[model samples]
Target: MGSERNEHPYGSLKDGDKISDKHKRELGRVRSSPTFRLGTLFTKSVEKPWRLLWLPFSILLLLVQVVKERVGATPRYSNSEPFTGESEQRNCVVFFPTNGVGLGHFTRLLSIARRMNKADPDMEVVFFTTSPTLHLLREEGFAAYHLPGRKEFSNMEASTWNSITEEMLSNVFAIHRPKAFLFDGSYPYRGMLNAIVRRDDILRIWVRRGTFKKNAPNVPIDSFDIFDYLIHPGDSVEPNIDEDETNNSIIHCDPVVLLDDEDIVASDVLKSRLGIPEDEIVAYIQLGAGNINDISSDISIILGVLHDAGVWAVMGESLLGSRIEISELPNVRILRDYPNSRYFSSFDFGVISGGYNSFHEAIMFSLPCICIPNSKTGMDDQFARAKVAEDAGFMLVEENVTRPRMKNLVSKIIDPENRQSMVESGNSLRKPNGASQIADHIARLIFRD
Candidate 1:
């Protein structure tokens, strides 16, 4: 009997004193308790509409906290003082080369101002430039303040910081007390920043174009502590010497290029003025802006090649009087104060003494150039630039121009195969519309509220 009872599957109940239905019912009730029901309800609540609303609210709260922390974390440097919100409406003046020495600097400055105006029309951009170049800027509908006197290379050395600073500051303060002042070129007038810094209300920026050449003698570093920023558009070309570092400085802005509708239109007009035939190939020859030393032999060599290829030559102001003998060449034309954009575009090729302005302009216009560097004027840099361009398959005249070399290079560029290759290379290397990128950087730095 014991063995049979053990074998039975329901053997655990034994004789359960009383097999009561009430005990079984109580066990079933225990499994359905309120605690388990409440747990299920809590999980369903997480998927309800109220949870969705709270989730977005929590995210918004997190974003607000992050932004507030970021704003607080920004560096509270002394340089930031001049760019405060209270000075937003104040005038911003830019002083650039106005004379016809090289329109490159002025054109680049103008392009920046135009971009600034487009970004914020309320901001004022005043130019304190030379008289001769004033007409060029005015023609483009820019409001500029023309400084008295002409640009004289003979007096360039004598135009010292002490003398020019007073004049520059006087002009700037007289018309409008600018909140920000910008200057172009390597040497900005000395004490100009000191005068601006005295006010404590102005920000001054220097737009430097040239890079220090390797192995060259060290140039004296100018003290620009009074200025808030020293913007190097092509700063990456070389590491700046420690002596050149400014105290209140912001570095690294894109290099400026002047490319606008007005510039294009003016260039087209210049092409017609220079008698450049629309269909024939044109070559622009510039022997440094207004610094031509000897041109008769140079022009003769250029004319010989142009005559052979039927290409027109557009010469700049420097070659004006030098072209007296070469004027007899039917294909040669002299353009004084011609718009650079038109002059650059009028040419399929350029024969230029290597200068930053002309080099960048040729690259900007995607024109092939035969660069003949003027070694006599400490322009050894042109040789390096020419070599780089030549390595990239663009035309280059070996340094120190000789009649035979000029003629040979000109002939090579005129050849359809060679010219086509140069054009393609230029198109590949061109960095167009850099001005807008520069402007955007400046606005962010100076006007970021």
Candidate 2:
């Protein structure tokens, strides 16, 4: 079977077909005629009587149906408080950061949580991530809970997993009683998004990023219409917020990393904490957590390049004890923490992946960077990210990162003119602390503005 011959939207014009000027003129004349204009308006005018007659009846029926459903369903408000203004009510904004492939999702949510708490100190911000990194949140004066990853439950029976997840979401809703739920992931779990709607009166906001790498895994991202607000914490250097691609109701924010200057340790403090020497030109290396997408293959080469250039490399705990000879070299030491963005002051330069949290923090802290995008992961999307920066000439980016490429890029970052160009470019972008701006958006929704 094939497409029908008359399938063209305008007409049956096929390849190599041309419309005569007379035909085009006739079509244009009819479209521009007062008769055709009046015909369209007349159609609308004729429908007005039916619409006026039935609209109120339809609204009344909807109201009655709502009353009927509420009679036996869960109460809208358990406190039995009468209808009041938005100011009187303290609302909670629940956040779901998906699972822990890397710390990007987790740290971005944590950043938003901090801003939300500060913006409306009275309102509550809750987190439900599958990562056990809630200890980081507790240290930051926020409350959070963990949900088991889908992979854990996916292995078992579907019926069993559904029942358990449904129950878990129900309990979360009952405990939190959120005014809104914000999700940050490519594929938000259906059970979780549906749970918010089931609870009723909860706005669902999605913090989705985009323009993935060619090889990025395809996560099931369907039913986007269910969300009330689709917030894109957009990249600083990438034109990632394309209207043609994303759905309506997208709220775009700039550089939504966990950037609280108060959390940034002084240069001496960070060095002392990491036990890096004062004489060493320490280079921070974080190619993501390496839990899902391992980029440790080039770790030895990268560290060797930096080491040969008289720079001690700092890494996360993932590569520290992995017995990689290069990472375990005398000049390399691990940062031993999640949300290592706070320790930006510790390093003179950085070799970072294009993960949202890592790259933006490097830009935010003005660290001259050589970005090696980790292209092998479940929606890590580092290759596309690095491509954007490289194309824009903002940062030194590498996709197929070889030892020679690493050497060249590292040397480029070391040059004063080139390093200053990258630093100035990053500085010229929208400033950090988009977390506060996002919090303001949430507050506006809560206040019914």
- What are the lDDT scores of the predictions, listed in order? 0.57, 0.64
lDDT of 1: 0.57
Which structure among the candidates has the greatest lDDT? Answer: 2
lDDT of 1 by residue, 1-449 (tens): 00011121211222231123224323433433344434434555576857555665555654564454334332111221221212122435455543333455576677788777677665666787653556656665666765543244346543363456444554454345454677765444433433354345555676655554555443223345555776665421443446345465656554456665345554456667666667788778776754435655775777777777788787765422333444777888776654454556566788886666677667766778888766544312556555666777775767655767777787788887888888888665565466777677677766554
How much is 11 displaced in model 2, in angstroms? 60
Q: Candidate 2 on 1-449: residue-level lDDT in tens?
A: 01112221321222121223224333544654445544544565467766555555655654564454334232121212111212222267778886655666777777788877765566667777777667777887777777667566647764455445545664565555566788888775645643454333677788777655555554433336557777777774454434564354878777787776777878887788768788677788877767655566778788888878877888765422343333457887866665677788877778887777777777677786778876666655676666666665667887787888888888877776886787677766537577777877877776664
The alpha-carbon deviation from the true structure for residue 192 of candidate 2, after best TM-score superposition, in angstroms, is 1.2
- Give each model a TM-score: 0.68, 0.73
Stretches of candidate 2 off by over 4 Å are 1-90, 214-222, 236-248, 318-328, 391-393
What's the true lDDT of residue 379 in model 2?
A: 55
lDDT of 1 at 343: 51
Clashes of each: 1, 0
